[model samples]
Target: MNWTVISDNWLFFLVGAYPYGPLGGLLLTLLLAVGAGILATLLGIGWGLSLTLTSGHIHRLLQSVCEVLRAIPVLLLMFWCFFLLPIVFGIDVPGVLTVIAALALVSGAYLAYAMAAGIAAVPAGQWEAAQASGLSQRQTLRWVVLPQALRIVQPSFVNQWVTLVKDTSLAYIVGVAEFTFVANQVNSREQVYPLEVFGFIALVYLLLCSAVQALGQRLLVKPS
Candidate 1:
């Protein structure tokens, strides 16, 4: 519980080498999580919407893809992206990019399922009403169905985002130089109290995650 070491090296743990060099630590972690989550959400929404359409073959294909991705562990996906990608594609992607790819694939699968459920929860009468109002299928989805679906599933969506934030810690295994990685580096160097180092790192994660959950609750409680 050495506050001095923490006070001195806090910046390093928060943004490893960023002020002096490249951006790393919690900042990079959040960047990867937020970017991947946003991309996955958009991709998932598109896939989910397409699933609702009258196309059996396309629905099966997309559903299978989502299932396969969801079945794979994030760590295994990270390994595949880091090691196998270069062998298969002859391209050397950075660790950050590998993490982004893995998270996006995983998050997209879960989001697809969430969004499909949300869309399915919408009443058929709403769809009929939209159609009777002279709205095309696309306009109906955009103006009527999606808005209500999103509202209904917002709490779950925010939960997914929180999961995304926590999952960012896994990026450290691939040498992505995020918050956990920085803390590990510091802990290794300052062996005087390794538990303290890790405890502080845990605290940081708890604080950030709690803040996200608080915000989500506030949003969910707000009157529509």
Candidate 2:
């Protein structure tokens, strides 16, 4: 129950040895999550729209690919990105980028499905109304379908983001030195007060996830 461990290493949990060394810890975790989330959103939008817009073989192929990606665990994806890419493709991605790439792929797969569901949930009348107004398919989608679909799935996106933020803890597996890794290092060094050390990190994660949920709620509320 010693609080001094947390007090002493609080800065390390926030940013490990920055200004003197490379940045790590919670800062790196957030960077990876946000970067992956942004990339995932872009991939999700493209894949989601393609799922609805394309048909026959192309759509089926995209669905299979997304399903395969979704089936793979994030840790396995990180291993492939970190280890296999270098051997197979000869592309030596940095550790940070590798984690982000893995996270983006994993989150993007789920987001694509969520988005596709949202698009499907859109009423048939919306498409008909758009076409009746002399809009092309592309125009109709851009003007009518996507907006409503995105709105309907906005909460899902935020939830996905919160999940992604927590997922960044997996980055430590690939030696990314995120918050969990830093805390682990501290715990290893101290070798006492494990409860306080790990408890502090759990609290931090809780706060971070709660903040994200709050932001999502705020964004979901229509301006009065």
Candidate 3:
């Protein structure tokens, strides 16, 4: 492996065309993942909880919307967000933000179902006990249900987060210049170290994903 290629171009891979150009690179990758994770949690869990707790018109409407989102491919979503967002909404949206939104929608679609399963896994007695204690339905959900449901689905949420991290690679198609994109650029320019450069890229992704998994597992573990 020509370690020097990575050694020399590490900064570019880490931060991309920064301080001189729009931000892009592994930093952008993290930004995209984190941003998407937050948005996905809000959209996915909120919808899941609402659907589980609600019924009739509200549930049917949400089910239809999420079903449509889930049916659309993530790549198509990214393209639509980038190309059509401005035209349809008549407002500018940067490429990176567009990618984040797309990833969030993709990840959230799956997460919503996972959250619903978690909520369903909660026992019926727990709901009754909360009501027996004179807690409102909202209070019961907030204090008793959410904690348990979210905890039960911790592994799934973590998996979705890791999946989103990997999906950041797709942003390259739209010129996001994240980790994979920057690495590819360096390899192309140098043209002598595909194996070495890609090997380094794999290592970086491994480290990133491992750290995330470790932290998630730690959080998911039962208290002693």
Candidate of highest lDDT = 2
Give the better candidate number (1 or 2) by TM-score. 2
Tens digit per residue, CA lDDT, model 2, 30-123: 8987799889989998899988889999999999999999999999989888888889999998989988988898899899998999899999
TM-score of 3: 0.94
The C-alpha local distance difference test score for the whole of candidate 1 amounts to 0.83
lDDT of 3 by residue, 43-99 (tens): 889888988988999889988888898899888888888888789998788888889
Residue-pair clashes per candidate, as listed?
0, 0, 0
Worst 10 residues of 1 by lDDT: 215-224
Which ranges of candidate 2 are over 4 A from the true structure?
220-224
TM-score to native of every candidate shown: 0.92, 0.94, 0.94
The per-model lDDT (C-alpha) reads 0.83, 0.89, 0.87
The TM-score measured for candidate 2 stands at 0.94
